[model samples]
Target: MSAPPVHDPPAAGVVRLPHTGLQVPDARLRVVRCRPHYVNRWEYRALLVRGEQRIGHIRGPLPDVAEPGPAGVAGGGPVVSFHPRGRAFTEAELEDFAAACRLDGQGLSSARVLTLLVDEYRIEQMVRGCARRGGVMARCCGEGWVHYIPLRAYPRSAGQCAAALAHLERASGVGGPWRIWDGQQWSPLSVGSGPDTSPGCA
Candidate 1:
């Protein structure tokens, strides 16, 4: 049987997202809740909202979507909860992953922990995906630029991967999309800054 519609006095016109064609009706969410998905333990299921009027909660990270963890939750890893958008790994989560992999992450620098995390992902592909190495869930990619991705979630496409570069833990640039940082901290790297660091420096 269909679940009884949880609405009183009903709702008005549903809001249709033009790009994705997903229609969401008017639902006031005073509080939102989240938990891991049951069937696809890989995904998370948010309780949608609290106190009555509500829209259905979201599933996993959508393409170009924002991080889905509850608001106010500090984002750092080795204990990251993976979303489509990359999430910072928490130290605890990092340790757990290390233990499962029979490796160690104790007292390591954040960058070093991230490197170790990437190494295990390389050494064990499917095992890492299926098992719980850390609380922060992640998927694997081959190598290169992805080596130091701060957010461990796998980028599904070029756009997704490019979007993540800005948030990378060891990224070597500045600003993003439009703003450029000419390779020097506090310096400028903009559209016509060109092959000369001399102008940005001085």
Candidate 2:
């Protein structure tokens, strides 16, 4: 005897279940690109963004140190510390960078500026000052709209991963068509910081 034919479900506007083999929508896929400053080390000085929105930049010169000796003492090998020196672009610088990117006249409101450095102590001091006065520390990472916010508080030493979260928080509170650097030029992110009630140019 012949077997019965099987019928498949309708395919029009039907929601499909998610599985390992399933394909997701292109909009849902996250793509990450890196612009490293150096090789063999974590010296990355590049802009980070999500979709069309700018997130921040990552610049670092990670240290390369050896392990301790048998007695838990310092070793004889040379102490290698990766200290890449590069200034984070300021709001004005960012405005120029953005202009170069052809994104002139764009504005950023209530945004924070973050800088990831090896010096934790310095960052801590700065953060403390900003916290007290309710101001933000603006650093130039590169020439781009993307900026970063540290997930944690500033460290207690220099060259530590100091979070620029407080700065961002303050920027948002003060109201800005704040300026930012886009590597090659500077541009505004929100509205222009005017003399009436905006943070003046830096």
TM-score of each predicted structure versus truth: 0.20, 0.17
- Candidate 2, backbone clash total: 44
Off by over 4 Å in 2: 1-77, 80-118, 143-202
In the order shown, what is each candidate's alpha-carbon RMSD? 21.1, 22.4
lDDT of 1 by residue, 1-202 (tens): 0112222321245432211122233213211454444553354444333246343333443213334333212243222222222233333543342222211111223222222332322323333333344312221122222221223443445575465544542363433322222122112122233332221100
Write one digit per residue (lDDT tens) for candidate 2, span 1-202.
0111122332243211111111111211111333335566555443444356444454433324324442112354322222212443344443332222110112211111112111222334544565566443343233323232322332323233222323554744533333333222223333322222221221
Show the lowest summed lDDT stretch of 10 residues, model 1.
Answer: 180-189
Candidate 1 TM-score, C-alpha based: 0.20
Error of 2 at 189 (Å): 5.1
Give the lDDT of residue 7 in candidate 2.
29
Alpha carbon lDDT at 167, candidate 1:
54
Model 2 residue 73 CA deviation in Å: 19
